[model samples]
Target: MMRPHRGLDPGSVWAQRLRQLEQRLRTKEERIVVLETENALLHLKLAEYQGLAGRSTNEVLQLYAAHGQQMKLQRSSAVTQLHGAIKRLKQDLKSLRSFALELSKDFQRQSKTCLYQVLAAVQGIQLQNEAMQMFQIKAFDLEQCLQEVTERYEKEKQKRKALHNNLIELRGNIRVHCRIRPLLPFDDSAGHSVSQDRRRNFSEKVAYAADDETVLVKCSRPGHASVNKTFQFERVYNDLESQDAVFADVAPLLTSLLDGYNVCIMAYGQTGSGKTYTMLGPQFDGNLAFSIEEESELGIIPRATQEVFRLISEKPPGSYWVEVSVVEVYNNEIFDLLAKDSYGKVFGIKRDVVTTREGKSDVPLLTHETVENASEFLHLVNKGLQLRVTHPTLVHAHSSRSHLVVTLTITTVVFGDNFGTSWEDEQTSQRLNKEASCTFPQKMRDSKSTSSSRASSPVQLEATEKMKQVKTRLQLVDLAGSECVGMSGVTGAALRETSFINRSLSALADVLGAIAEQRSHVPYRNSKLTHLLQDSVGGDAKLLVMLCISPGQKYLTESLQSLGFGTRARQVQRGQVKKKTFPVPSKGK
Candidate 1:
């Protein structure tokens, strides 16, 4: 079509077509460059994204593997714990069921047993109630019978006491009791070697207790036949006798002391023969420190003191007053053992014995301790004993160098039925008026005469009612141990003491010998020992001499001398000791 029109139009159309092709080609080339640059940037970004994605993928895979292993371990542990919990629950359930079954069984058994016990207890209680009623009835009847018997027994006891007292009075008041001490270890060992040959030839047993009241001594001479001598006494205690047995025999004497009678108990013997032991018990062994509960071990002094207080307690209060004095005759001088200075220091003060108008001996300036009970009395006694002069010797370990005398003075006042009037009332008033008149004659003469006349009048008869007072003394004498110089082996001061002791003892023996022989004069002034004991020896006081002896053959001479002394003492008969009773004037009569 263009070929027909063809000429210049064809050429223009062709040129236009060529320009358009070039423009299109250029536009395509610019798009291709932009696309290529974008493609290169996208390739770099994809490479960075691939690298980051590769690292994240590796981290995620590792996390998943570790999480899977952790989950597996947790599941295994949970399974194991669950299995153990189930096993424990099963065991606990079985134990609970068994315990419940056993508890039911125990409850059933206990209920049945309780029912039976309750029934038995009810029956037993009922039986006991009936038995108690019967016992009450029997007890009433027994009490009535006992009341009647006690009345009769009391009447019989009074009669018996009267007869017993009469019997004791009939027995010689000056009674001698002999006691033989047991052979000690020292006694056995003393002359063992020297007497070995003598032991073979001569019998060690020289003295024998013939009976309860007699001692038989046989002389052991090598060339001569044995001469057996028997001595009788009021009571004789063998070596085997205990302190209680000896005290029992002397118990009645204490009763006489409470009956208002003056009593003297003295122990005399050779050294180491138990003279002190008989009166005050053994020394150097704490015998003096014994308690009151140890009654069986108490000696005469303690027992007598306790008994006196017991008897006083039986009486009404304010009826009796007891006073005690402890003194020792050392080196022929009387010393108050309980005497002390204001500073509580014991002083060796000398004492003098004076004879009262009533014929009783009184030591002037003596310490008179007022005691209420046995303990206080014993305390005073211990104070004196501690101050007692004692020294050791070859024969006796604890030898008393003095004579100890413990005196208990009891003043008892008995009230009469008539009150506000006493025998002493008129007498005391008369004496007072008389004394006043003598002092001031002009003023008191008329008053004294009127008072005397009134006192003698019948209106004053009721006022003259008698008030009896009983004053008694109990003397416990612990004589110093008599020793031979050769046997004692003493020297210096001890030897001098021994000589004084022997002389005093000899003087005592002389006095007793004179009394036994019924001499005109008893020679009580021969020594202080005899002079101090004048009333107890020859007066109305009852005297009991305890002659202690050693049973060993080595002490044959001393034992014989002691037996002879006891024999003489027994023969010295004293008058029946009457209880001291006198009318005491009431105060402000």
Candidate 2:
């Protein structure tokens, strides 16, 4: 390959060398272009493979992310379910605990019941035995002794009541009790109170129970000297006192009724001063029966009724019976509330009060209802109260329009055989009064001996056919309020009622005033109310005046007026209460 280019002409050889070098350079360039074309194809294929792998990786990553999210949601749901289950389990556990506690108590009660039953059975078996027979006899003896003790206790109680009445007679004073009512809702009159704060500051209380037997009244006004007055009373009940407490002090007077003495209990006060509330229990709708819860809150009338029946029960069977007469003195006219029509419907009937042969006032042909038990008695009274005149006024929503008088007449039958030998009870009254030698203990012995004799002797039993009847009355009077005309805000018919009420109250005051002044000419006939209350007001009867008052300064004038009335009443000089007896007609007559 070297010899062909070496032997050519010297200039020509250089040209040939140039041509060969050009051909070699062209071949190397063509080879480089082919290699570049293959490399471009390889680059295109590599990019295609890279694009496919990248798309697959992206799909795998998305699926992995979705699976991870699904796992997270499942774990969260499991945790939430666990928590909910725990909460439900906790609630169930609490409920189960309570149930378990109640069940345990129930089981204990059942166990106690079973034990009691077993003991009762065992006691029954023991009682059938001979040794227990002796014990039973001893128990009977003990029971008999207990009964005697109870009888003695009842006698002592009656004696104590008698002593109390005697003491009152000796003192020449009437029992006057003042009761201060708490601030009622209506006390804050809408016309007076501008705001809640002002209500408290407007009228401070002016009257208060200073002690058990004294009332302190403070009269204060703007830019004036306060006038303080103190009044004495037989008893003073504060705003906090319960109805039971008020009745406790008044309960002893009821015993006098069975002792053949008249017991007059009068409730006097201004309108909205709790007179009705003190006389009848709260919410005294008159027609409805009393509820069990309201039993404890019963006022004077209901309690007195119950007391009358209780005392009657202690007497000999069929010895005493009660008859009730209810009358309301309205506009100075008496209306019988227990009057019945042909259809047996009760209504108010106008009646006239006539004077009896003994100068005692009596309502002729007034409706009288005989009751066997306290419930029947209360039912009759409630029926009468329905016919009672009541009107609403500015001072009170249910103001009494008339004076109510509920008289319970207790008829006590005395066997004449008791007067035959040694007994002094309703027997040998003339001798007992002349000698004054027989005492309560002596009377008790005599009654026992007479009872034993009656049990043994047919002669004394036959002599029991002749009996003596004595009737004593228990009068419960609820007086209408002596309120001011302007304060009552009444118009037309109510105004007339107000006038009548005021005049009647004034007449009562006059009677009291006359008695206090020892005037020979008492004005009892001046008003029907005075005439009706003749025996109890100034005669020989136990008179108790309950003065209900409001502590607010707004009712100061009325309070003072009532206080004056009560003071005049206390100063009256009534003689000792005397026993009343009526002769019974023969069986044929």
Candidate 3:
């Protein structure tokens, strides 16, 4: 027995306490029932006595009331009995309350222990729920990030797809043609004498003489015969057939203008060359001549107009009307030839700065007119040319002191098989496409028109909304000839003219040089001529440079320089033409 003694087990100890609490609870219940029974007996006797006093019989009832009153006095004993029972009940209730207090203390201790255990379990469950929620939130955030990445990738793919579809190339076969001027009555020997006389006076003759040298002139067309001669250069290209051949290669492009493609044709050469004659036929009217009757008379401008008309005629009548804007870049200024303004003043140049599909700003919009035929177009162009300032130099007569730009703005509408509606109003149709005319800075219009001519007339230029519809510019440029300052012996105002001419021509050369070397920055903004031709030379315009040469050995150096310019121009590759579709206005503002 003394070997080992086990401490009280937790389970047995709890069971013993529960049993003791149950015994005390039973005794309190029995005592409460006894006290309640005694109180009820005393209350019943008091009620009986009161009822006897309220009876209906007079004397007998009064006596019965006195008897009831005595019984009531005797009933006072019930109060003593009630007090004794209450005292006993109070004693039992005190014992029961003491026991209950002890039991409550034990219950409190057990409850505290149970609550701690429950709190620990609940805490573990809450931690698990929080971790699950955090994981779900992280998963949702990752899903959203993946979706955004996919959307960005899709947008980039669409941009690439659009770029892939807009690629275009020069689609025609390349051909080279030369136009020969007709022979003049002045023999080669006579021309040489006159050259010698001019040279002796100026003392500015070239080292090589025109003794055995000959000029080969050919028509621009396929079947025309070449004229070979050992004479002056100007006399060689004087024929109509020869001039026609010069513009033959560009006929297809001119036709496309009427078909809604902006086309530009430019000529570049030295002074005294056949550029003017080639572009504008030397004013000739041989309607009575039998040889001219069967043949198509071609001057570059006239032929171009005819071609435009031909293409437009293939469609319905009045379907296409060409608007022309003839402007000149004189010295370093822009002059609207068709403008009725003062000599030194001209209309401002405006262009819509648009972003092409390639995200480039090479496209420009120009303002122009709707011309009916070649004759009407020529009238406008001639008016502009007449307004231009020309001067005579010792080397050449009526030398163009500035660059001439002729913009043929062609607009074609597809009518709904109703010619009446088409011709009724030009503003009715929605603008489908827009072509830019030559984009020059408006500031260039401030330059003087001539050394002596004053700004007399005010510009009465009328603008058409149709001009805003042109997105592509068809620029035909005839640049002023580069001259040797020393040889020209220019002085006074002529000196200023010579300087401007040199500087501008030099700038043009620089641009060509930079472009030839693939320089990122070409100085097109340096000169007005360059700025006006910005579209044709560097923008999305297709350019053609015709280097007119004098085969005379006397002009060999100048001719070589002109050829060098053409070679440089050929190296420039301005991506491709970006065609823009004009959105139909809800209501034009």
Of the two candidates 1 and 3, the one with more favorable TM-score, higher being better, is: 1
The total number of steric clashes, by the backbone 3 Å criterion, in model 1 comes to 1
Error of 1 at 474 (Å): 0.6
Provide the overall lDDT of each model, using Cα atoms, as 2-decimal numbers.
0.70, 0.74, 0.52
- The candidate that wins on TM-score is 2
For residue 48, model 2's alpha carbon misses the true position, in angstroms, by 90
**Which candidate, 1 or 2, has the higher TM-score?**
2
- Go through the candidates in order and give the C-alpha RMSD of each one to the true structure: 33.4, 31.9, 33.3
Candidate 3 local lDDT, 280-332, one digit each (tens): 65653312132573334445776676676676666544334455666666657
TM-score of 1: 0.61
**Candidate 2 structure, TM-score to reference:** 0.64
* Candidate 2 lDDT over residue span 1-589, tens digit each: 1222444443444346556655655665565566556556655655664565466456545655777776556555654664565566556556655655665566566556545655554554566465768889999999999999999998997797567656777755578899999887777773443576555543568889998789999987668999899998778999999999999988878886777777899999998888888998887654336677787778899888888888877765555657778889999999988887889788999988777787877667777666767787777888888888889987888999999999887766554555323333544444333333221123322321121112211111123344456567788999999999887889999999999999999999999988888888999888899999998898877899999998887788999999888888888777666766544443343
State in Å the error of residue 562, model 3. Answer: 0.1
* C-alpha positional error of residue 438 in candidate 1 after TM-score superposition, expressed in Å: 33
lDDT of 1 at 280: 66
What candidate 3 gets wrong by more than 4 Å, as runs, is 1-241, 284-298, 341-367, 414-472, 580-589
Of models 1 and 3, which has the larger lDDT?
1
